[model samples]
Target: MSANKAVGIATVVMVLCAWAYIALSREPRLPTSIANGRYSNGCCGTIFLHDGVMTVANQRVDYIIERDKAGPYVLPTAYVGASVHAVVVKFDAYPLKLRLDDAAHPHQLELLDDAADGVRYSFTRVNGS
Candidate 1:
């Protein structure tokens, strides 16, 4: 075979090998309580979680939740560092549970009774459609 043809065949083989590895070794995806997307309570401005960091915003103030991955998402309680209106506050292990209304829809996060910095509310994902 020509050098160009040999390189093309080798590239296809390598791609197939990588794809097979990913397809076979994939772990069962566990549902996460902390979703990485934009969420809204229909009252507050918006809430966003990207790459383990969170931002809480409203009409008046915007709070910053620091990068915290020290806790587990299994339990109903989680603790993290938060800054509410420039004042640092510790969210002392509050209840953070996930309520899945149906399998056809995304899970609804239920943060009951002041989960973080007096922001006690349940929020769902913002539908792009």
Candidate 2:
């Protein structure tokens, strides 16, 4: 093949590789198995779960949870209660199948896991009900 043709082919290949990387390496979305929302146990305080980041009292911790699986999983950065495993448990008669607990009692929240600050948190929601 002509040298110029070879170079053109190489460029095309490089571009294709880059496109594939950008497309495939994009971060996965928070699993559908988890509801996205703001949760509060009232006394325990409030937490926001969105886009794979858990914000507790305004401090954000990036995390990943595989769909329908439990975690001893690692977060993207260090978080107070980094050591925890999570699974989506079914709760009764609630639209949020992945929610921490029954939403009927707004004052109550369950501490599915403990973070570095020693606070119990249940994060994995996109918005409030």
- Inter-residue clash pairs, candidate 1: none
Please, what are the lDDT tens digits per residue for candidate 2 over residues 50-127?
Answer: 667766655665555332233223233343331244322222312222223432222223453333364345543223
lDDT of 1 by residue, 24-110 (tens): 873333344345566555543355554445555321222222121332232222332222222122355442333323333443333
* Every model: Cα RMSD to truth: 12.1, 11.9
Using all chains and alpha carbons, the TM-scores for the candidates as numbered come to 0.36, 0.36
- Model 2 misplaced stretches (Cα beyond 4 Å): 1-33, 67-77, 80-128
lDDT of each: 0.43, 0.45
